[model samples]
Target: MRKITKGIAPVSFMEWVRQKPRNVDDNQWFQELYKQKRWDIVSDLSHHNAREQFYLCAYCCSEISGEGQETVNEHVEARALASHRSLDFTNIVASCKTKGQCDAHHKSQALPLTPLMDECETEFHFKISGRVEGKSARAIESIRVLNLGDNERNNKSLIEKRKQLSHNLMMANGLDPDEGLEDDELLLAVIDDLLTPTEGRLSPFAPVVANILRSWISG
Candidate 1:
């Protein structure tokens, strides 16, 4: 998992949330909030969250196209369990569709290890085979609950995708004619680009890519 830096909530959305009636029951409160045509504000928040994640699903690290039911405003804490935080921007994340056994569907109310935490990235190790191993129980549970590596009928498992990506990265870097030459400055530059975040959006599974690159370099 990559670290996600949550930014300040949009002013208008914050103001809207603040104005909601505090005395109402949770269900009523949510009903009113939705009835108020606040979907645009929700969309805005989702977009911002997506940008922070480089348009990738927070759990699976898959690219979210933000098109026709491809994305959802995922509540990290789960609205069923934390209705009070239903409208909380900090509790929200943009995830991919939950039609399959994806994170949103599998995670429900279970609190998985989040990218928002500082130690999130260090919890898991990505292998060149595309498998992810957790360094702790929390990470392991999160991976299982999110179905991060589970194979689906029609779709490639997340690990399979990561493995392919790892192979591709190696192939790209290995193609250099002066690969092990002392003055192979281009090699370092290429590796740096793969490991660092770009000015625009990052490639999907960026953390996985970085892991593969780092292992290759160490070897």
Candidate 2:
């Protein structure tokens, strides 16, 4: 997981969206507000929400089902509105989890880690067992909240990536993949690569992503 500082919505725009009263139940008010702030609501929401969803499951970071695969919009249920600040854009995010789960589980102590505010990429890394482990209590809480292991559809992707990385590393050194590096060692090497980018550091998958590639090669 990487922190995506690129293309973040402007603070002013976020402030504007945050002012809207999203928690209200008046359909007429909501309809009117939606019409009034259509551009602010739609464009920024589309971009930022999609960006958020792309990192983790829109609702739960434990999964990779981003926008288009599920209801990526950060949906707030009537019951959950009580806890929301306002209908502002800051309160919402893209989510794949059903409204029920997003509302019930997200509000609880066991919410999945979100890349938006949680920054699990800074704190967590993949283990040899294919589980995502992190340093913060919030990171661990998020793992439990989203049930990263329970979601086979999403976790399988990470597992496959790790396997490929291990294989690539072994092949690079003309050794069997079964003789892979330790998980922590691989993570440290990845960090080293991240800190040192040799080329094309400004591309979409830049310095940090390059390090991930390096780790896979050195598996």
Find the number of clashing residue pairs for candidate 1.
Answer: 0
Q: List the residue pairs that clash in candidate 1.
A: none
| Model 2 lDDT per residue over 1-219, tens place | 444333565464566545646565433333444567655544555556555444444433333333344434443333244344334454455555443344334553434455445364555554444445556886666655554432345455545544455445435434443454456565565545443424423222222233333445543
User: Model 2 misses residue 50 by how many Å?
Assistant: 2.4
The true-structure Cα RMSD of candidate 1 reads: 4.1
Cα deviation in Å at residue 25, candidate 2?
6.8
lDDT scores for all predictions?
0.66, 0.45
Q: For each predicted model, how many residue pairs clash, with residues at least 3 apart or on different chains?
A: 0, 9
lDDT of 1 by residue, 2-94 (tens): 777777876766877677776875535555655886777766766777777777787777778654367776777877777777777777777
